[model samples]
Target: MDSQTMRDLVMYWQGVTLDDEAASRLAALSTSVGKTLNAVAGGSMFDTEPAHYDRALIAMAERSDD
Candidate 1:
């Protein structure tokens, strides 16, 4: 997309106007997702313990009726 179209889409997703600082921060975060994926591919320090991950699917299912 052209810069103007991309800016419009970003503003829409942000649900408000994008000032310079906020726009830059969001763009930085967008770039970080790819960096995180690359780090995960190399193996993550945060993934050492399986028990640290909470699989709350059963709780979510029970709460769905409420």
Candidate 2:
């Protein structure tokens, strides 16, 4: 998934504005997942499944102690 697309998804799910820093972080995660999973740009590549995305984001948040 592309960075912007990921950021858009995150923001859509949370219904919140992701600041530059946060968007960057989300974008980075998307990039990492894309690389790891061989996903290309756009929405179809990476894991965009709502439940999985939420779980992954929660896991990441927990990992960061946020």
Candidate 3:
């Protein structure tokens, strides 16, 4: 996700007003997490398969709903 989206998500989950500095820090952390996720996904062969990934996501969502 982009920085704006990440910032919005952080703000929503944090449920507190953030100053510019705090927002910047959260955005940086989001970027780092995104990079790490990309790296891990790149290293995984299973993630390359779209259908399986979609199915896994669906399964997880179903479990959460249950």
Candidate 4:
């Protein structure tokens, strides 16, 4: 996200105003989180914990009336 956009989002959503240093820190944290999420997403979905998603979906489908 753009720095300005992130700052705007922080203000809009969190009702907080960030100075330059805080904005830079927030940007770094946001970048780290994005990279971490990307790395996690690169792994196989089946290996995720509690990986009974397919079974849960099947159960949900069976329970659906239509």
Candidate 5:
């Protein structure tokens, strides 16, 4: 995603303003996450099933409740 899209996402989803520093960090994090995900999934994000994504999110929520 582009910087503008990331900024909009942060503002809309998290209800927070994105300063230059925060935006830089978010961009870096987004790149790193995309790289890691691509590496793990053989460069295709669609390789994973949608159900797997939902299950992973549910598991994360359960773990956070601990």
Candidate 6:
């Protein structure tokens, strides 16, 4: 995620603010996590579906029921 998005998440989701140094570290950590997940998911792209796909399906079902 972009640094601004990361900062927004920290403030919006976590309800906290970090200093410049901590924000930069948080950005680096997010980058590292994204890279690792990409590498791991690359091989399994065809073999597996995203975990969120289930949530989407559930939401669709709920909408239909409504």
Per-model lDDT: 0.64, 0.70, 0.72, 0.82, 0.80, 0.80
- Best-fitting candidate, measured by TM-score? 4
Higher-lDDT candidate of 1 and 5: 5
Clashing pairs in 5: none
Q: Report the backbone clash tally of model 4.
A: 0
List candidate 6 stretches off by more than 4 Å: 1-4, 43-66
Off by over 4 Å in 2: 1-6, 39-66
Cα TM-score per model: 0.41, 0.40, 0.44, 0.55, 0.54, 0.54
Screening candidate 3 with a backbone cut-off below 3 angstroms (N, C-alpha, C), the clashing residue pairs are: none
Model 2 per-residue lDDT tens digits across residues 1-66: 555676788778978777677787888887788687664554463554446777678677744544
lDDT of 4 by residue, 39-66 (tens): 9799667756776888878877864567
Candidate 4: which pairs clash?
none
Instruction: Kindly provide the TM-score of model 3 when superposed on the true structure, using C-alpha atoms.
Output: 0.44
**lDDT by residue for model 5 over 1-66, one digit each (tens)?**
667778889999999999877787898899999898778778545555566777688777755556
The sequence of per-residue lDDT tens digits that candidate 3 reaches over residues 1-66 is 445665677779886766667777778887899899998777657645456777788677745545
Q: Could you tell me how far off, in angstroms, the CA of residue 11 lies in candidate 1 after the best superposition? A: 2.1
What is candidate 6's lDDT per residue for 7-60, written digit by digit as tens?
788999899987777778889998899899998777657766657987878777
Pairs that collide in candidate 6 are none
Tell me the deviation in Å of residue 7 in model 3.
5.1
How do the candidates rank by lDDT, highest first? 4, 5, 6, 3, 2, 1
| Candidates 1 and 3, the one with greater lDDT | 3
Stretches off by above 4 angstroms in model 5 are: 43-66
Ranking 2 against 3 by lDDT, winner: 3
